[model samples]
Each structure stands twice: as C-alpha cells, then as structure tokens.
Target: MGIRGKDRQIDNIEFNVNDISRSKTFYGSIFGWSFVDYGPTYIEFSDGRMTGGFTTGEPVRTGGPLVILYADDLDCTQLRLKAAGATISREVFSFPGGHRFHFIYPDGYELAVWSAS
Candidate 1:
C-alpha cells in the first residue's frame, strides 16, 4: 500500500471506463482480479500483486499508454481474453525475450500480454 521503498517507480494505474460494473466484470473474469469500490464512480482492483483503479469520473480515451501484462501461457490467456469480449488488436508476435499480443478492451484501451515461452 505504501510506495516509500519504490522511488520513481510506477505506482498506480487508472482507467477511465464507461461503465464501472462492466469493467470490473470483464477484468475480474479474465485476470481473476479482485475489486474494492470507492464509490459509484470508482473502483480499485488488485491482481494479487499490482493494484489499479477503474474510474467513471472522466471520459474514456484511447492511445495513451500501453499496459503490458505477463502470462505463463500466452495462448490460453489470449483465448480467455477473446472469450471475455476483448478484440484482438495484434496477432501474436515474437520479440527478443518473448512473444506477445495486443488486445483492445471495450473501453478502447489497448493492452498487451507477453510470455517467455
């Protein structure tokens, strides 16, 4: 909860979503993330390691930042994301360290998932 030991590190990430409930449900199902509501307009989520927030306080905008996630099984994660109604924006591609793919959430935020396999 405290970032005192993490100087100059990325602390929190927030997403402006159209519907808080819908965002919670989608992210919860795909990543097994847990949520805590601050109010009707905002909710915080934890993926057991990192925490972020879903907020309806601002309008949803795209093309800001790229949030990349790690997955042990890239193919399976991609399948789950697609099943959860996310659109696959980029096909799986290989890079120096691993393979990755990008997906666009309903709110138009683009995120990538990568694996070492």
Candidate 2:
C-alpha cells in the first residue's frame, strides 16, 4: 500500500526529544508502542493503529508534538496552506521516506505536510 489513498489526511506525529532511547522506553512501557531505530538520531514508533517518530535532530521542544499530514502533491498542499494564511516555517526537506515542510498556522501551532518520494 502507498500514500495515494491517504491524501491530505493526518499521517504521522513527531516529537523532538533529547534522548531517543529514553522516549522509546517510556512510550513502550506506558503505551505499548513498538519502535524501529533508523539511526542514532531517529526512531519510528507504532502504537498498533498509528505511527509516529522521535528524533534528536532538533532541540527538545516545550509546547507539543508536531502533527504531520500527508499530501499526494506537496507543492499544491503548500500553496493551499499559504493561501489559507499559514506561514512557511521551514522549506521542503527530504527525510528517509519522503519530503516535508513545516508551517505555522494562524493560531501559532506548528505542523508539517509530507509527500512520499
């Protein structure tokens, strides 16, 4: 299966943490999430029905986890977000599985949109 059927849907949630192992241990013990390490800096987690990730690539944030959405066409989605008053916080960047960009919505919540490469 691919992301073709999940266009514009809430896809993954991500957290920036100081320690990936600690986060994995905590979530695994508390919520039974299973994790797959990508490298020293990142790990993917699955809680049965949903998937997310923890990364040490960024500083530990205080507000909340980043909510990510999937788009079949990243550029189109970005344009729509911009026209809806979102501020592009980060330009598109490639990760392991896809490319994504960050944005801040009107109320100051940061989110991301990704499309599979």
lDDT of 2 by residue, 10-93 (tens): 999999999898999899999999998899999999999989999999887789999999998889889999999999999999
Off by over 4 Å in 2: 1-4
lDDT of 1 by residue, 1-117 (tens): 122343224445668888999989999999899998888888889999988778887678675535667676778888988999999999999954578787999888788776666
Best by lDDT: 2
Model 2 collision count: 0
Which model scores highest in TM-score? 2
- Give Cα distance to truth, residue 43, candidate 1, Å: 0.4
